[model samples]
Each structure stands twice: as C-alpha cells, then as structure tokens.
Target chain A: MSTSHLHPFDAALALASSAAGLYTGHTSPAYWNMVGPFGGITAATLLQAVMQHPDRLGEPLSLTVNYAGALAEGPFTLQATPVRTNRSTQHWTLSILQPDAEGAPVVTTTATAVTAARRETWGVGDMPMPSVPAPAQCKRITPAFRSEWLQRYEMRPVSGALPEQWDGSGDTSLSQLWLRDAPERPLDFCALAAMADIFFPRVWLRRARQVPAGTVSITVYFHAGSDLLATTGSGYLLGQARAQEFRNGFFDQTAQLWNEAGTMLATSHQVVYFKE
Target chain B: MSTSHLHPFDAALALASSAAGLYTGHTSPAYWNMVGPFGGITAATLLQAVMQHPDRLGEPLSLTVNYAGALAEGPFTLQATPVRTNRSTQHWTLSILQPDAEGAPVVTTTATAVTAARRETWGVGDMPMPSVPAPAQCKRITPAFRSEWLQRYEMRPVSGALPEQWDGSGDTSLSQLWLRDAPERPLDFCALAAMADIFFPRVWLRRARQVPAGTVSITVYFHAGSDLLATTGSGYLLGQARAQEFRNGFFDQTAQLWNEAGTMLATSHQVVYFKE
Candidate 1:
C-alpha cells in the first residue's frame, strides 16, 4: 500500500521494520495529549501492529491497554507477541517501550481476536440509544483550550459540555456527543478502537475541575464486523459515556459507540487515576 | 498460617510454591463449571498468586483475564511476573499454562495494582443501587442445574431470573440480585473478584434459547480498599449486570457490585462468544 496519500491516523500508525515481532515508530505531535500521545492513537497504533503481523488470525474481539509509565516524546519500539492461538481464537500481548530506559514498558496492550467460523445464532441489543438531536442539529464545540488532539476530531455536544468551574451542582457524570475524525477517515477496527477512548474523563464531566487524571487501563470490545464498518463509512458516531463510581483517587467509566442506525459498534471500559 | 480451617474459596486458591515467581495449583471440583473450573475461581486464583508474591505491593486496581484455551482439569503452573513497579503503582503479567501442552497458554491475566498512599479525596457514586427487596425477603434460587460453581454462592434474584427455557419473551438483558459467598467467607479482593463474574450470561436473559457461550475477556476495577472491604465483611452484596450489545457472534456485559450500605465496590465488563 502506498503511504504518501494515507490518512494521518494510518500514517502515524506506519511502522518501520526492526526485527521479528518488533517495529519502530515516532510519536505524532498532531495527536499529542497533555503528556504523551493521545491514548486512543497509542492504542490504535498497538492494534495496528497486531493487524499488520503476518501470523495474526481473525479480527479483534477485545483489546486492553495499561498505561504503565509515561512515554518520552520521541522514537519508541513496539513488541507484539502472539501469546496463544486456539482453534477459533488468538491471544496477543503487545508493549510500547522506550529503548535505553530501565524498568517496565511505557504502555502494554493485550488483545483477544476470534476467527470463529460463526454459525448463525441469536443476537440482542438491549441497551437503547439515547434520544438526541441529529448530528447536523448539534453544535460543534470548537477547542477553546490548547489540546492538539482535540482539534483532530469534530465533536458536537448533544448533552454534556465540559464544565467551566466546579459549581458542585450536578453530580451525574454523563456525556453524549457526536464525533468523527476531522479529516473524515472511514471506520475500521483501528479507527473504532481509537474512538473508544475519545470521550473526556468521566471525572471531568462530574466535577467542574480537572484533576491529575489519566486512564490507567482501558478495554474495548468490538461487536461490528468489517462489513458494518464499510457500510457505515466515514461518518459521525454517537458516543455516550458515564462513570459508575469514583472513590479513593480512582474511578471507573463505561462507554458505548453506535452508528446512526442505532447499531452498537463497540463498548469500552476504563479505570482512571485521579488526584483530588 | 495453617489453612486447615480456611474457607473453601481460600483453600481452592491455595498454591504451593514450585519455583521463583511461579506456583502450582489443582482444580477444585467444588468450584468447577460446566467445562473446566468456574472462570470466576480461575480469575480469583490468578489474583491470589499476585497477593501471595513476596515483593508484591498494594492491592489490585484492575485485572484483565483472557481465556486463551480450555484449561485441562489437572495440575497447572502459574507464572506471575511483576513487569514494572513504580513509586505508587505496579504492573503484572500472569499466565496459566499446562505443562506438556504444545500450543498456547491456557489463560493469560494482566493486572495493574496501585499502592497509592491515598489522601482523603472527594468521591461520588452516581450509579444508583437497583430497587430490590432485602436479602432476607428475596427467594434464593437454588441451582437445579449441574454447575458446581453455582452452589458456591447463594444468589437471590431481584429482577432477571434464569429462563426456564429459551423462550424469546423478554428483550431486556438485565439481572439484579443479592449474592454472598456460601458458608460465609469474609469479603476480600479475591472473593470480590469472583463474585463479579457470577451473573448469568446476559444473552440467555434476553433470548428464549441458550446458545453456546463463553467469556472471551473480563476486566474488573476495584473501587473499594481493604478498609472498606473489612468494614463490609462477609455480607451480601447487590449485583446488577446488563448487556449493551450483541452482534457478530459476540456480546458485551457490564456489572456492578455494591454493599448493603449502597457503596459501590467494584465494576466489571466482559465480552462473551456466543453461537446460534
């Protein structure tokens, strides 16, 4: 595949050969978070490594990424190893590490991919999509802050907006928005994986102030196949996220991503570390 | 400490040192599922390995277990490695492997533990406890089925009950129940982890017929510390679980565990593979 015309997400995910099961890449400043690269991109890049591997079987069923340490804004290496492969499922462990640094990897992502020769079975989606205005009707909130990654996505708030100050009025930590890649990239496993983490920290939504908050671990379960993504194409997705509990300098958030047809594409969960 | 009078849960989790950072265990028939050991017990056992580690620090903040293959009912070796240890957090990778197996490891579990010297912080749990009758008022659904694991916990259904047959009547995949360890074991991290997975598959609750189903991956985030667990101690906990989506032979379930005081303890998410 030619790389010159690839989307920024695809281009940033491009890797250079280092060795068997290992590749090297640079951090994209465009997707930079306050500290390291945006977690979604980092997660997407890790999934890309597995997808590009010749031995990988089936499609991504679930992925878990643990941010073990801070990533130095420079070059880094990714090591992806197939931990196990069953008749219908495969397991992989991937790590993004900074060379010459002692200790554990900066980020570790584990995934389960199932290549089930699926038999037509029963299915159900009990969770109802939220009643919200159409994407065009919602107002796009431009970045009033200086987050490079925030600018890369077109986000229209359908309900919750980032609180300006801690008024301590509303206690519900819920956010519903319409989101799509700014330059408009078609939906795929990689893109969907990244979109899962695009929601702002639930703590921020609940409390008016931003504390030292970052996702320590996040997991995504993909429910849609490539055909669904192809049919959906590059379009806005309804993203809804809410926090279940917040306690002892930590909290947990659960989120769902859906197509306009109310088809649930992915559901994600993450435990975040926050300082009061 | 002598384990002669230890709870069955603790006894089943008992491990014998085989080598450095590795232990051996046998499948306890008391906790066996339809196929291998109950996945909840398996998950608890993996967490037990970390807690028993000499150099382990802090308590589990999050755990992700990927069932890579069917665990053979025999002696299995567990290799738990502390991948990284920071000032306030630690990361671990664990594998359950049956020796002499040619292919993949049986189960792979990864965890992040935070040893944070937590300062008093603002906390809020917006997720309300489901309106259910008290434990004493609800009927305990004795398992007429054959799974040994079902007998280990006393479950009182408050909302969704296991369908008598696969009759497609209800479309809501929600289950609310009061549960506690049978014979009354004190609430601890291992026991709590096991309780998080005790809910019946959400698909079965929504569909009329049972299809082949198994959890591919499950992640649990602990919101309570040892102090909270100790205060709650050996009491019934309210659990509510619901599915957000089911498609392409996979479905996702989210669950919460809370004490009688309406304190949210842990939240979990899992994706299951299903067949028609």
Candidate 2:
C-alpha cells in the first residue's frame, strides 16, 4: 500500500502490514494529548484497523474504547481480531500493546467495534438541534491551551468556554460548540468517531480548574450512514455535551453530534475518573 | 457456593466455580426475554463475574455489552480476562461462549467493564429528576405483555404506556416510569445495571406498535456508590428514556435512573437494530 495518497486520518492509522492485523504507527505530535496521543485519534485509529481488515462486513454502528494504560512516544502495535460475524453484523475486538522495560507486551488500550449492514427504515429525529451561530459567524477558539490535540480541531464555543483560571463558581457543566478537523477534511465514520470525543471534560466546564481526570470508558453510537456524512462534507458539526451527575470521584457525560442540516450523526457517552 | 441463601439477583448470577477467571452459569427462566434470558440480566451477570473476581479492583464505573449471538437454554461459560490493571483502575474483557451442536465453542456475548477506586469529590447533579407521582400513588402495571422479563419487574408508567397494539401513530418517543425488581430486593450495582435496560424501546413508545427490535450494544455508567444504594433500599427508581433519532434500521436511546430523593443512580445509552 502506498502512503502518499492517504488523508491525514488514514495516514495516521496506516498499518505496517495487513498480515496478522499488525499495526506499527507513531503518535502524531499534531494530535498529542497531555499524557499520550489524543484519545479521539487513538479511537479512530482502532476503528480504522477494522475498516481496513479483509473480513470487515459493514460500517461501524457502535464503538466502545477503554483506556487502560498510557502509550509512549514511539511506535506501537495494534492487533484487531474479528471476534464474531453474524448474518448481518460483525463484532471486532482490538488491543493496543506497548512493550515495557521487561520486553513484555502491556495492553494500553482496548476497544469493541460493531458493524452492520444498514437499510432504509422508519426514521425520526426526536432531539432538537441547539440554536447556535453558523460556523462562519462564530469565532474559532485560539490554541491557548497547552494541548496539541486541542490544536488539531477548530472549536467555536457557543455556550461554555474553558475556565480562565481555577474558579469553582460555575453553575452549569454544559458546552455547545461547532467543531471540525483543523485542516478541514471531509466527514467519514472514522473521522466522525474521533470527533465524537473532542468535547472537553464536563468537570472542566463546571469548575474552571484542571483536576486529575481522564475518561475510563467511552461508547459511541453512529446514527448517520456514510452517504449522509459524505453529503455533510467538510463542514463544521454542531455538538452539545453535558454531565448529568458528578459523584464519588467520577462523572458521566452525554453528547450528541449533528450536521448543519440538523441531522443527528452520533450520540456518545463516557465515564470519567476524576479526583477532588 | 451455596445458592439457597442468595438473593434472586445473586442466584441468577450464581456460578459453579471460578477457575482461571472462568465462570459457569445457567439462564434463569424468571428473567427470560422473548428468546433467551433478558439482555439486562445477561449484562448484570457478566458484570457480576468481574465483581466477584479476586483480582477485581474498586467498583464498576462503566460497562458495555455487545450481543453477538443468542444464548441457548443451558449452561454457559464466561471468561473474564483482566487485560490491564492500573494503580487505581482495572480493565476487563469478557465473553460468553456456548457450545454449538457440533460441540465447538461459539461466542454469544462480549463485554467490557471498568472498575476504579473511587473517592469523595466535588459533585453536582445537573439533570433534574422528572416530576412524577410517588410510587405508592401510582398503580403498578399488571403483566399485560407476554414477556416474562416484564412480569419479573413492577412498572408504574407515569407518561408513555405500552400501546395496546402496534399502530405506528404515536407522536413522541418518551417514556417515564418507576421500576423495581418484582420481589422487592435491595438495590445494588447489578440490579441497577439491569434496571437501566428495562425501558421498552423508544420506537414502540412513539409508534404505539412493535417491530422486530433488539439492542445490539448497551452501556451503563454507575453514579451511585454502595452506601447510597444501600440507603435507598428497595424503593422504586424513577426512570426516563427517549430516543434522539431512529434511522436506517437502527435507533439510539438514552435513559437515566434516579432514586426517590432525586439522586441519580446510573445513566445508560444503547443502540437498537430495528426492522420495519
């Protein structure tokens, strides 16, 4: 396989070879998180493995990723296995392993992807889109945060802005933003899956300061087909995320992503491990 | 391994023996769905495996289960593998395998569980509890539906009632109800996980009709700690569920579970495969 013609996302997920589902890829400094590669890109890379597999059946309907350990800055190996294939759906389990000092494989990440053959059916959109300025009217958030991953996405916050400093007086943990790939790539399932996780932690919105918080697990349900995303093209997506409850050093956030046409593209939920 | 003194919830998850993190359990007819055991019970059972494992750390933060195949009415083997164990968190991958006619093991279900050592933290509840009548004031829904799973739980629908028949004319896909175990068992993580999935499909609520619908994947994030659940006891839990969108043979639903005191217990989301 040649690498010159691939998009940035595809290039980031490029595998060394298809044999044994082995992938050796370096973390792009462009999408680097504070500790490791951005979780969204890591998630996208995992899904991309299945999408490129020879036995893949359909597009991803749902994906769940659990961040177990931190990844180093060098090459990492990913192994994706098609665990089960039904008549109309396929299930895959993937793991990202990084060797430790002892030369033993340590699982850094794990994920489950469900793909299915979709057909036209009764359709309805019950969630109303939040009224926000169009991407053209909104100002792009400057990269004032010290995160490379934040720099990879153009975010226009319509409601909740990142706290200026550690002020614990904010009342609401809701954020509505217009987001897209920084370089303006067209929408696809892989990119959409990654975009689903671009929201800042809800706790940060409630309290202005950074806590020791990280997402333990995240689940995404894709509601739009590839055709819908293709039609959406390289356009900004309207996203709204909020936490329902925060307790016992943990909180859960729910978010929905929609295109400019108000078509719901995906709904995502995750639980974050936070410290007081 | 004495089942005689166990709660029904515990009895349903009773395993013969756990060796090398493997568990063997049978499907309880009390919680049977249309075909196999209720998806909720199956999910709870899988989580129970990890809860009982010796290597398990902390409490369950999030769980995701994917139904790959149907479970036969017999014994099933569950393998819980601790893929990663961090300082304060652990990740597990589980599979429910049942032998086919030819005696080859076939994976029927797969799940991921994240557990962490939780500590008290600055907390807030952003989602307001739905205003509904107290459980004592509401009438319990008698078992009119054919599902044995429905008979196993007492439901008091405050808003959307199951339509007498499928007519495809209802307007909205919202259901608000008070739900509890039939025998009035004390609430716990396993029971709460099961309760998260007890809501009927939102399509049925809107259409006032039934179509072939099955959940492909479901995720639940536990918000209440053991102390809170113990204090809440066997009281009915207020629940509200609704779908954001239904399109292309699939739909996504989000639900929240809360105690009578307006404390959120868990938040759940799922994607269902529906045929028109």
Candidate 3:
C-alpha cells in the first residue's frame, strides 16, 4: 500500500512544488554558474526543507550545519535527509550542493537536528497569534532592488534602497517588506528558516555602506509554523537591532522579529563576516 | 605599563568589579545550595580576576573539570582573558567553572569571544530604546503565590504572574517582564546571558508550573555590553518570548533582550529538557 502520508521521518525536507508561497525557492541570474553565491530564497528554501519537514517519516528533527566553504554568489541545490528517525526524536542533515562545471554535484553542508521533549509541568502560556488582516486584505511590498535570482522570489525591503549606502554607518538597521510563500505556492518551515535568515543582523549594513564584513554566526528561533502563502503583508514592522562584537570583519548582531500587528515573533542573532 | 582595560567579551558570572562600578554577589535561594557544583562560579571568579584585573599576576585561565555525570547549577562564574587585543578587535575566552564536592576546584567551560570593530558606515540606525524607568523603578509584580527562585530574581512581571485558575491544556505563549539584576549585583552581556537562560522560557510557558531540566543547546547573541546594575527598573526588558519547538520532555525557545530605553541588546535561543 502506497502511503500518501509522509513517514514520521522524511518530513524535514518537505518538497515544494512552486515558489508562490511564503518562503519559496527562486533561481538566480547566474544559476548555471557554480561559482556564484546562493540567493537568499535558495538559502531559505533549503532551511525549510531541512528543519521543518525532517520528521514527516515519523521522527524528531535535530541538526546543525555551518558553511564549510562557499563561492560568493554561486548556484547550488539544497538536499535534506533524515539521518535517524526514532519514536522519541528525529535527526536530519541538510546539504547545499553545488554543481561542478561538468554538472556534477559537490556538497557544502550537513547539519544535525533533533526534537526536544515536552515537560509535564508547563508554564509560559501561548501569546495569541496577532489578529492579522486576512492575506487578501494585506498589501504587498515591492522588491526595490532586484538580482537575476531575487527576481524569481518576492521580497520587500521595508526601507527604500539607498544609493551609495555602502560604508555600514547610515541607516544601520534593516527592515524587510512582508513577503512569504508567493500568491501561488506555499513554503515549509525549513524554507521559512532560510527566509528568516534574511531578516537578521542589519541588512542595511550590506547596502554598500559599512566595513566589508564583521559577521560569523546567524541564529534563528521559530515560534509558530507558518504556511508561506497564508502569511502576507505589504509593509513590515521593525523590531530591535543590536551590534555587539564588530572587531575586524567578524561581528555578531541581533534583531527581534515582529508581526505586522506589532506582536513580537522571534529573535534572531548572527555573526557576519564582511569580505574586506 | 601596568594598565588594564576590560574587554567587551561577556562573562557568565556577574562582574565583581569594573571601572564602571563594582557588582557585589548575592546568593539567592534559587540555586543557593549548588554554588559548589563542579566548575561553578568559584572557578569563574578566579578566571575573571586574571582577565579583568591586570595587577593580579595570574597564569592564563585554562582548566578542565569532570561532569561527574550529574546535573548541577550555579552560582556560575564567568572568567575571561584577552587572547589578543587590538584597536580593531579583541578576542577573549570565558570559562564557567564550579567547585567540586570536596571543595576541590574544577573548570566547566571555555568559550571564545570577540569584540566588535568600530566602523565609519551607518546603514540602519538605532531602534528606539524604551523611555521606561530603570529596572529598580519598574513596578514589582509578585503574585500572591510565587516561587522562591522567582522571588530571589525579583521579577516585575509586566503582565502579572500566572493566573490562579488552570484547566490543564498547556498554552505556552509570550510574556513581557522587567528583570532587575538582583542581589543588588550588576551583570554584563555574559552574566546576563546565563541569567536569561534561567527565566524567560519558564515565564513564556507559565502554564507549566514545574521547573525545566531537559536542555540541549542554549545559544545567546550579545548585541553590545551591558552592566545590569546600572539598569534601573526599565533597564532590562524581555521583549518577546518564543517557543520554537516543544515535544516529549523538551522544548526550545528564544527571547529578545532590550535596555530600558528599548534598544535591542541581544537575542537568546535555548533548548531545554524538563526531565522531572
């Protein structure tokens, strides 16, 4: 009997059929070029596949991955797999694969993820999900600046792009226009994780304004799993942004996540490395 | 020149002295009896002395301690040493230590840290810090019924404590609270990081009354440095509490940190396992 239901495992990499959802994957200008960097959407989609769906096979999800190596602005495929699916928890590995000049593939990452247990004595009650205007009533932000790849996915920078914004000092914070699974497609949690990564540190720092780079780690926490298409907004709500360790080209900063209604969502922290 | 400059690296233990001011230590009933746990605060203080005070002739702090296979709590000590200091950046390591049962010494942790580099560029600027009063001035909300540990920390729950009525379906959600550096002690990014681990999650899950013990990973992002003592009633704000994943006897959540001015200071994500 072919089971239509995904196994308790194999859920981390919930496959996506299109990019019309909240965190959709888009191809880049230099798609065939293996040396170019991966677009934000690609990163988001990979994350969604790895973190959100790993447990479909009936297991828990647990894993971590670091960029062992990268060719700035490259093309790659993100593949997620279930490493171990147990009754208590499931573990998974998500890999970013770059196709060689010959169309052969090279692996870039493998993170281990696990699911934690729940406590019998529970406390922090849930914050009600903000009463969001139905997506149909929400406005959409336009992608001010576009890349060959960014064009495939929709993103609205909360602030209009700045010209000569590169030295890292003016408008040091960043807020993005609300864009999720596009109108036609829905994104998974792994994909959402990837998309949220774009929401951290201060994206404005990258508008050709700051020192090359002072970053190393980027971390994200998930609150409610969102269906990419169902979550929509034209404008964006900016949370908190902070810079702590910025010595040299390696720095760590944090930003808080909030909904359009101003309800706090999640907090994001990461280390960024500027290519000086 | 026999001169010393405090580094921006965060220390897990509250600072005893700083050019800013001295922060006296106090033992709260929360972890009162666990002060002597392996590699607890005792060791961290010695490490702090060597790292923070230049006049003290101490070898670089590095020691290994055994877990002895049991869970333990603090008074956790954070000791730091500058691995390298420069105008652009400084690298340091902080160790969390504890004393053994026989009063013997043991080392718990050695974490790498780096200070942020000064820059000329400004992309996005500062988020509005709250105009709220200092933490000490904030209204202290003590539930008619409260936990000893919660009291030791002096939490001013902005939304008030968990309600007395409960029907049993766990509804872990978001909570806002004012946290003062208790025992009249001040804390830096590192010390605050550890303290953050102590509460927020429990508060967000207020529906669950039991203490949580099952923890997998605790990731903290320090935005800038903060001395908790100088923080008045509004000094420290728990912006948002998020429950990312919760299953079995474990859960993972993230909390945003802000100064009284409402400046985003840091973000922390933790994986906890409540075995009891």
Q: What is the lDDT of candidate 1?
A: 0.82
For model 3, residues A216-243, the per-residue Cα lDDT tens digits are 3344444433421136332343334444
Chain A only TM-scores, each candidate in turn: 0.92, 0.95, 0.57
Q: How does residue B236 of candidate 1 score in lDDT?
A: 93
Task: List lDDT for all candidates, in order.
Answer: 0.82, 0.88, 0.42
Task: Report RMSD for candidate 1.
Answer: 2.3
**Order of all candidates by lDDT, from best down to worst?**
2, 1, 3
Better of 1 and 2 by TM-score: 2
Better of 2 and 3 by TM-score: 2
Supply every candidate's count of residue pairs whose N, Cα or C atoms clash at under 3 angstroms.
5, 1, 152
Cα error, residue B46 of model 1, in Å, equals 0.7
| Chain B TM-score (model 1 vs. true structure) | 0.93
DockQ of each: 0.63, 0.88, 0.09
Q: Which candidate order results from sorting by TM-score in descending order? A: 2, 1, 3
Positional deviation of B62 in candidate 1, in angstroms? 0.4
Please say which candidate is ahead in lDDT: 1 or 2.
Answer: 2
TM-score of each: 0.95, 0.97, 0.51
Show model 2 residue runs off by greater than 4 Å: A1-7, A18-20, B1-7
